[model samples]
Target: MAEPQAEVDPKTTEEMEVPSSDPPENDNDQDAETPKKEKDAKSFDLGDLVWAKMSSFPAWPGRIVKPWKNVKKPAGKKAVRFVFFFGTEDHAWVKEESLKHYEENKATLSKAGKGAKFTKAIDAIEEAIVKNQASKSDMESNEQSVGTPAEGQTTSPYHPPSDDDDDDDDIFLKSISKPTKDYSREPMAGKKKLNSSQSASSPGSSPRKGSNSSSPFTKINTPLASPKKRGRPFKTLEDGEVAKKPTPKKRPSTGASTAAPGKKARSDMSFLSLNLYNSFQAHLAQKGETAKKDIKPTEKKIGFIGLGLMGTGMAMNLIKAGHDVTVWNRTSEKCEEFVKAGASQAETVSDLVSSCDITFSMVSDSEAVRAIVFGENGVLDGISDGKAFVDMSTVDIGTVTGVAEAVQARDGRFLEAPVCGSVQPAMEGSLIIIAAGDKELFDECESCFQSMGKKAFYLTDTGNAARMKLVINMIIGSVMCSFAEGMALADKSGLSQSVLLDILNLGSIANPLISGKGKAILANKYPPAFPLKYQQKDLKLALAMSEQVDQPLPVSSAVNEQYKRAKNMGLGDKDTSAIYKSLTH
Candidate 1:
């Protein structure tokens, strides 16, 4: 069937009319309202100071002789070039288009600026003229005072102030009346450029024998200096040598005093202190930016050592979280599991540490942890001052403390984060991590641990995590042993294991471990939720720690002895629930 077409309304058609080809014809009126281009271009004045780009075309130490402008030119070209002259006979012609507006204002421009050499000369001439005028006025006053004498006599008999007069005028009169001597001594060492005119006037002047002009100090004996000398008056050595009078010491330049306090008073210590402060502030700002980026999508390079059963799953979670993960294991074959899940493999501990920014180790026991941490090719060899190392193994408190000290000595950060729960929790990414280290390092690496665990608790010291892990596993061992004894007693009383488990589940005796692993134990299933050997190690460490702290743990010690018997019987390779077999036997 054909579709029906709707008719367009007249008002809607007019609203959608096509635009005209030509623009609106009020362009002249708009231009008249707008300001002229010349007026805009004349913003800069003759003496206005501006900053130009420090570039090769204008050269270094260059200045603009003219300001920016817009000049009409031939149709083909749209710009007029301005002249800029640099020192050392260097100059360039730059287009007005190439120049930008100067940042400084007219008041800032110096009269003795780059091309204004005449400014200094003009100032000197004006100063000399003022000095001459003052001297002429003083001389005219003196002549008038001397010519008009006392009017007591018909013919005035008067005299100028005599040098021998004991009056108030003696100071000025005596200094001028004293006749200067013409004493001239030999020019001493390092006086190579004695003025010829001065030496010629003093015919009695003679050289001091064997004194060379090349030495730094010169010794000369003279009374009056020749007015024709060009250079400054430098002192000459020799007692009674009335050499050329010394020039007054120059005050610091006015330009130096005009500078800001920060610029004026500078020392090596101040400069270094300021530099250090600036560097620290810059680093903090960079870290803040990095933290913001981390909250978004970030690629972290993670190292996973000891790719055992738990390590494999934890490494997999990190990979799923889109981290760059590298794995290492003593057995070497264990890394293949994570390698299949897109992880890079490290042949040795050093390889892992050297490649990653943060390293995670989950080895077997205290000894295994030590081997990986302090061996020749250990993580210490790869760890650097800025790198962080995390040990997730259940070990003795002493071992953790020792490893932490070693890492600290090397200027590396250390975090002991032993986990609770076994292989199942590890696989599900639900392990509980207890961490201890520097607070900043703990906070920085918490997210990486979160990838493998449900939550992490930061403690105070490196030994805290190790002690906590031992305490938790001691409870697990005691509880598992109790359940084993109860089950054995029930079996001997002719009650079915299923009925006993069901009854236990209904009562307060039931717990997650008892319900979950007890069912498996009742069915004779021991797939190693927690390995028996590791459980035994944790029990041993806890017993020793308890003894040291003067705390009693009779049940944990008994459970540890049973684990010792099980280990001796070669059941150490079995799951922790195999403790029941040891108890029943």
Candidate 2:
């Protein structure tokens, strides 16, 4: 039996309260300390490529980039780079310790890193890096041509000395070079220092990107300050040549990215969602409507795939909650009921994803998940900038990560949302949603989740939801098997089985699983609510997960065999309480 979950019924979604925070920089930077920096003393130069490690993922081939959506200084002040991973459409301010030369993990730079599909990203990043370098060279040449400007004529903004010249800012992380500058707290030359407005519109000044670009802003959770605060304030000359000045005398630009304020751009997952949200709010403001804090956001087009026992109930709840739902299933017949119930039907998964803003998929296993998502005209084909994909199926970490990468690589948001409940809870909109990935998407889908679940928690990362779901179901499967066996023993001892159930239900052992399944067992009818086969499947997956960490699970191991035994006895399709029949037979 499971422990009682929290009944979180706050008036508004938690996202409304927090508005979401910075990405997991501190968490990922734990291993990026001084010791690791000391271990690898080699310095990286601009356009220098390396293999950057992120989370537990395979080290991806990344280029040392001076321009990214958010170029924050890396940890330990290591000679690190904000690496833009070529094939994966991901970027990280990786520590020098967490990176190695590209030749380490990869053999050679083919057009394809993993496969031909990734060739586009590889070519794209390479072109961007080259273009950036070429642009810098051009700027430098122009600066040399211009020489010094007359006192009043602004030749260009100041350019800082090269990375080798400055130990105080060794990383040369000017997008955030040598991050210790502490832009907001630190002052620039007492009172004569320019503010954010001056940097944005000042004569010959270069603009900085988002303050959110700095993990420091995220750490402090403050609104963006002027980019001049982060990097040196540079002014564009009439001839477009930038000059250099001594540090502490006047700040100098790193000449990393040409982009300045109002042109702040990011090409990651947050790029689309954040821009969309800001645009929506801007529209409301332009119309003189109440601010977003008070205004209810427009609902997203909802999509659901799989119309099995659990999927059906969940989809029906979404419709009943007045969502504009479009549905798809492997079996076409199952979609008819939903179509008749004010829901629209999609001809294929691609069509479903194409038409919807957020698509929810719940399949039996990882293989089925792959077949739909990776199949022709599947999710990969349909994913675009404005759409999000939430897979609520019970799956392993590998499958979840694969789907997440594929979707994000294409600029589509993905969340692993394996639910914890069966048919009854699904129909009642009382399932517990364990979701991870795309915090922005989670915030946007508040109403849809509220309609489909009793409570939904936004856990961290992409694979954690699957892990949590597996562990929960593992316990449920083991307990149900134990319950089934105990009932069989009561009957064999010639004791009253009904009385035994009453005692257990009345005592500490009582939970929805035992109490509900116990009644069905007593009635001798095991209609498939939570199928025995699926229960066994969850246990099997849990066992596999345990093996990865080298943890022993003797109890779950034994329980899994019992489930297999029951399945062999043709009780696979029946409700889990039918495991009693396995004991009896």
Candidate 3:
């Protein structure tokens, strides 16, 4: 509007530039800037060798296969990325900041020489990458051929290549190369080259010394030396002498086939002398006896009286121990069983005592014991010097003393051998024998004692064995009474009887007797191991003995009443554990 705007031409107004807010670009400035852009862009390139740190793996050498970018990020904001191949079919995406140019790290890389195995592994990885790229291109071009089957065929799932097919390729990448020895030989000034066969066979054919100029590609002849042992070499002596080996000692010779004197002979005996000795002895008996063996005394003849419950099993054990046994019982039928089992039967108790060297009597009571010893044709009628009598009956102490005195008057040895076990121990040969009387008689009858019992205790006086047997029986009766009461109390108290028995078995008072008898009581079936009547009789004798010695045994008296109560209930024929029924019923 000022001065009508000079009516400026449209093209001139457009060409007229306002004062520029930014500086203009020029050719010299672009020439100066070109190198800077090029330097930034050329920091890394495809196919460039680099040392890169990928994840937590060690800094390994890799080749940049391609440039990459994060498509999710804003343009030009993300870090420059590269796809690197790390020599095994393993490729990784790495950032440019984590990599260094291979040329700049040559000093560090040269320290680890590219060994033969490493070179082979790198070559293989490159071949694999090329093959993989080619296969991808081929698959794209033949896409229509894939997943389409011919007529009458079904489409199957595509199977990837098997790992086992490339196992050898994997093995090569994992292998480590051995170090090569440096054996460069200098080139001679006028020498001719040798062929491979001549160099292999010749010895001492090295190049001349002072030939400083050597060809880097020249292969020197090196003998393959034997490998050295791993540890430090055996040390040499300071005087340069070798060590001497130790001399071995010679062994002395033993005399051939001859045993020394006073030792058993080592004569080569026949099988008849070794394996068939017992059969040979029997054969000799079939013929006349050999004079080489002297006739020994026939084994001592043993006599047993009163084949009762305990007596029958005790006599059987004696016969089984190879004694010449003669047996007698009042019933006479009991003797028939023993007579059939290789035992001789005596017509009467007096015949048994007179015919045998030792007589053992296990009669019922003091009166029965007296009738066998002092009655008509009794043991006393057969007593004489060198003959022995062992009374194993549980009798009153007075009866035992009387029998001992009568036997001593007849000049015969007497032993009051009262046993502490009943039928089971008698059958098993494990009774506890308590013997008191002539010590020489006890020593003479030790084998007989062992055959009938497990152990024997020798008391010096005649009546002491009987007294000890009573004391033990007293304790047994008291314990049985207590056990019966305890079982009865347990039943009434709602506790398990078997569990209570188990607790008692594990307690300090546990023994074979309690465990065995406790089980019998729990089953309420009293198969007689020891007759209840016999236990009551033993208890009665124990109380009488205690009374004779002026010893008060309130416990023995109480247990005796319990046994009598059991006997009154007609349980005397049952086992001693039947006393439990007396308490509970």
Worst 10 residues of 2 by lDDT: 181-190
TM-scores, all candidates, are 0.49, 0.50, 0.49
Predicted candidate 3 versus true structure: per-residue lDDT over 107-203, tens digit per residue: 6743443433234334533543464455456657877453322211110010011122232112111111110100000011111221111111011
- Give me candidate 1's TM-score against the actual structure: 0.49
Candidate number with greatest TM-score? 2
Tell me the deviation in Å of residue 494 in model 2: 1.6
Candidate 3 residue pairs that clash: none
lDDT by residue (53-146, candidate 2, tens digit) is 5432334556765432122343234344555455332334555666777544445534223433235345544554454455556658677543
What stretches of model 3 exceed 4 Å from their correct place? 1-298
Q: What lDDT would each prediction earn against the true structure?
A: 0.49, 0.54, 0.52
Positional deviation of residue 291's Cα in model 1 after best superposition, in angstroms: 24
Q: lDDT tens string, model 1, 160-200?
A: 11112233122111121111110000011111222111110
lDDT of 1: 0.49
The 10-residue segment with the lowest total lDDT in model 3: 1-10
Q: Which stretches of candidate 2 lie over 4 Å from their true place?
A: 1-298
